[model samples]
Structures are given as structure tokens and as C-alpha cells.
Target: MRSLLFGVIAITILGLTSCQESAKKTPEFYKDTVTFDLLSDMKSLLDENADKITIDDVNNLNGAIRYYSPIKDSLIGKTIGELIEGQKQRTLSTNINLTQATAFSTLFTQSLKFNISEFQKIEQENGQPLNVPTYQFQNISGKSIVKLSGVVDYYNGEQLIKRFTIEIDKEIPADKTLNQPYPYNHDAKNQRDVFVRDNFDKLRKVWIPTMIEFADGKIYKRNPDKKGENQLDKDAK
Candidate 1:
């Protein structure tokens, strides 16, 4: 009876030891990996709720680590929950101001209109006729436009042929139109016309307002598109 009791106690001790060892073992995926490779693997393992990993997902993860150096030590051996908690803590530590820039931009764009009113022909010093384009900006926002800057994309049908910068520092009052000559010379205008004529079937242009400043000292900037082509905001028409 004494021998049987001793044998049972030994077996119990051995079983407990085996369980502890199993708990101490590192997961196979985490061993001998660091940096982006480790982050990529971690993201794949952690995001089980996702249907599948996407290129954007990978790119965003990579971007997160790109600016921070020596992140390998910080990320290794951390679980998904731990990583998320750390991110939240970091965000709380940082100071940032969220403003109503987008809302203001939407309002301004909805109230403004742009068009090429006409082309005026002028005789140059060399007795050559030069065609200059005129632009019209109509403000119906019930507020004056204090300052504006953006780009105009000239397209032939659906194809973009030329781009020009537009800047206005003076005040354009509510319910009024501001007519001005194209900021560029006749040579530039002729160049654009020729380029469009040779490359495409139809000529059209879109005004893409990038930044605007109002009288109250608030500013708005349009968000850039990732594909390098900016579209006219639907609200602006």
C-alpha cells in the first residue's frame, strides 16, 4: 500500500511538470522573426474576423511601422489585444486638434461655381491675334470668399490634357461673380487649346478647389486621392 501511494504521487508531479513546460513554449509563428515580416505574420494571425487579407491592409500595416524606427522589439511576442491597447495608449498621449475643416469645405464647394466664360482675341505687338480665355467664379454661399487656391484640369472628352493653377487673394462677396482673365499668357492658352485639339475629341474642364480660407480665419483643404487623380467633389458639380 505504501509503494502504490508513492507511485501515484510521482505520476501527479510529472504530469504537472509537463503542463508547465507546455505553457512556457513559444508559438511556432513568433520564433526567429522581426520587423515587417513579423508584423505581416502577426496581422494575418490576429485578423481572423476578416474575410481575407488585402493589399490595402498590408500597405496600411506597413505604413504604420514605416515612420517609427526600432519597432521590432516593441512588437515581438505581443498578442493582438496587447498591441491594440498599446496603440490606444499612444494615441491618448499624443496631442492633436480635430477641426470642422471638412464641413466648411463642403459648404464652400456647394455654394461656388466655376466656368470659362469666353475667349477674347487681342492683337499682339507683332500684329498676331492671340486668344485669351476668361474665367468666372460665382459665389452664392451667403458668405464672402476671402482666399482660394486650387488647380483646373483641362480635359479633352474624358482624357486630361492640361492643368493650371488658380489663386485669388481678394474678397469675392456673396451672390456675386468675379470675372478675370486666365492667370497665364495667350501663349499658354494657345498651347493648351492645341494640345486638347490634337489629343482628344471634346474639350471640357473641371475646377478642383484644394484650399480655401474664410473671413473667420478658418481654413479647409481637400483630401487628396490615393491614385494621384483628384476628382471634382460631387457637391461642387
Candidate 2:
């Protein structure tokens, strides 16, 4: 009887020891493995949620254009093409782009709250034992800028082990008035007002395409011709 009791106790101790060792070997976070693809996961998350938020700064720009009332959109049937083009240039000016991207990032992360519970569906699809989420932005401007807030999660399979909060802010331009919705240089009845109302759709057209191209890593050294050829014809003068 004494021998049997001792044997039972030894078995129990070995079982407990085995469980402890297993726990140790199991990674608590996905980052423990070098095989993790953090960037891809983050890109997925951002792409999935890109359109969910109606960005206020963008809305403000739209509002400014809307407030100007009805616009003819063309000067004597020639299309106020120059004015439309100018607005696009100013709207996407390098400085303004940086500022807008910074503001957007700040707003997006604030709303996201860095909550892991919100990402359960994503984790399951990606495989789990999630590490913290993270992200990187390529072109931090234009319509595709909407996809810049990449909240990435690491996953082993269906189990969330870890999550990282993606946070980024670009430097605002030194010029305080660069991207202001209302420019002091222009009055209520100014060319700025006229241009916006006339070219409301134009803004979306010119702005969105450039950004989409940039996001896709398509950089145009110069404007392409009808055949989409960038190289100029050497035979031509």
C-alpha cells in the first residue's frame, strides 16, 4: 500500500512538470517567431478599414467647395481647365499633403483605440498567437492616404497572442497657412471659391488617380502619352 501511494504521487509531480515545460515552450506572443509577417498583416487591416471613417479634414475641404454655391464649371465652353488644375496642384502641394496625412493619422488612431477585441475576425483569417499590430505608409497623401492607417496584428492561428498599436504622424509644414480651408489671401467672392465650386468633381478625379498610382508604386517620371508610353518619340523633333 505504501509503495502504491508513493508511485501515484510521483506520477502527479511528473505530469505537473510536463505541463509547466509545455507552457514555457509555447510562445505567448507572435513576435517570438521570426516567421511572422507583420507588414502584410497591417496592410490587410488598413485596406479592410480604409473606407469606414469619413475623414473630417477631407470633408472640410469638400464643404469649402460646396459653400460657394453653383458653379458653371466652364468658361465659354472651354472648361476652366486651368483653374481646376491649379486647385489640384494646391490641394496636393507637398506641404499640404504632409499636414493632411499627419492630421488623418492622429484622428484614425484615436478612434481605433488599439483594442484587440475589435480584431478577432482578422486574427482568425490570418492565423494567430498575435503579436502587436504595426504599419508603414508609402505615399502619405491623396485618396489612397485613406489606407495609410495600417493597424497590423500578428497571428499564429485563430488565437490572439499579441497586438501592436500602429501610430504615426508626419511633420506639419512650417507655413501655418499652407493647407488652411479658408485662405486669408482670398475673400468670400474670390477665384478660390469659384474654382472649387466649378471643379468639385475635378478634385476627386485628379486627386484620387494620382494617389492611387502613387500607392501602387507607379511613379510617372513624366506624363504618359495616349499609348501609356513615358518615353518620348526620338524620331519626332
Candidate 3:
């Protein structure tokens, strides 16, 4: 009887540990993967409308496209005029203008720009030196951003050194400057300084906004796979 009780207790503990490990491996959200067929359709529409559409128009359409089965099927072979009309009709019926939603997202993203001002060495309460990076975000889009999340890739000359995801849930008012420190702190000032100095040239392109949320509850998300050459650039030609 004593041996059986001990065995059951050990099994229960191992089961709980296994469950916790499995939970940790699960992601908070899955990637919104775009299909190759959808990409081909988007390219087809752009090629068909090359002479008729502006870059902004293309951007709006790119933002408006959805990967869901029904919507994706409907947009497979649409002309420029057909695309615009469809967007309008869908907006009227669903009360959601994907194009407009995308436009707002683009506006908010383009409005905010960031630059690392300097690296400071501060003494902590424990009398240890901490190296913190001072950075500034300038919002010029005349609209406030409620939340923003993205990946910041730090490069040394041409080689990638560090990549980290940054999230700001606080309200950032339009035409205002927000000064904040990088979330990471280093113990060695010399190492931090060397990394910063090497990555200065690529600083401007470091911030790639993956998602943006406005005060009105509209959210915009960028496809992770399409990093440097986004749909706009691919379709513009």
C-alpha cells in the first residue's frame, strides 16, 4: 500500500511537469501565412493595372487583401476597377473598409520614426554599472497610436548581431516625441558602445513595424515573410 501511494504521487508530479513544458512551447498566436496563389493573384492585378493605379492605390489594395478562403477566392482575378468597386461594396455590407483600415495602419506606421540618441552608463542601487540605450520616437502623423509592436534588428556593419521584439502599449500622441530607453541593459559599457558604434549606419532601417493598433481599436499587421520586398514594391513595377 505504501509503495503504490508513492508511485502514484511520483506519476502525478511527472504528469504536471510534462504538461507545463508543453504549455510553454505553445505560441500566443499563430503566424498569418499567405498562400502562393494569393501572391500570384495580387501580382496579376498589379500587372493588369500598372498604367491605371498610383502607389498609394496599390498600397491600399495590398492592405485590403485578406488570406481567408472566401475573400481570397473573390479577389483572384479582379481588375483595378472591379477591385475598388468590390472594396466599396464589402465596406457597405460589412461596415469595415479593409482598404481604409490598411491606410490608417500605414499612416500610423509612417508617422513614427526612431533613432538611438546615446548610450548612458548609470550606477544602480546595488552600486553596479548598467549600460542603457537612449532612443527617441517621433510621431508626425497627426493621429495617436495606442499600441505598436515590432522587431528591431541590430546589425554590425553588414552582419546581423542581435534581433529583439519591442512592444509599446502606451498612448503616443501625434506630432509628439517620446523618449524611452531600450528594454535591454548591459553590464559592460565597452561592449555595448562597440555594438552601437558598429550598427549606426543601419539604425534608420532597424525598426520594422510588425503590428500597429490605433485608439479606435483598428489593428494592422504586416506579413513576417515579406520583409524587405513588401507587396507594394513587388507590385509597383
The model with the greater TM-score, 1 or 3, is 1
Lowest-sum lDDT 10-residue window in model 3: 228-237
RMSD of each: 12.7, 30.2, 25.4
Misplaced by over 4 Å in model 3 are 1-109, 125-128, 187-205, 228-237
Q: List the residue pairs that clash in candidate 1.
A: none
Give the TM-score ranking, best first. Answer: 1, 3, 2
Instruction: Write down the lDDT of every candidate, Cα atoms only.
Output: 0.61, 0.33, 0.60
For TM-score, the strongest prediction is 1
lDDT of 2 by residue, 1-237 (tens): 999999999999999999878655522221221112522353453345445322443343234334332654322222122323334565566556466455444433332232222111122353432221122233323323222123233333443322323323332221211121111121235554344334433332111111112223322221211222222123321
Per-candidate TM equals 0.47, 0.16, 0.44
Q: Tens-digit lDDT track for model 3 on 85-172?
A: 4555654645444454465446546768877777666667877655566667777766777877777767766666666677887888
The number of the candidate with the highest lDDT is: 1
> What is candidate 1's lDDT per residue for 1-237, written digit by digit as tens?
999999999999999999878666533432333455656666556465353334443454354444344654665554433444354455444422123344544655776888888766666787655555677889877777788877778777777777778888988888889997863334534766556444433468788777666665555566433222323344431
Q: Which ranges of candidate 1 are over 4 A from the true structure?
A: 1-105, 127-129, 186-193, 196-201, 223-237
Candidate 1 local Cα displacement, residue 34, angstroms: 16
User: What does the lDDT read for residue 12 in candidate 2?
Assistant: 100
In model 2, the Cα lDDT at residue 139 comes to 34
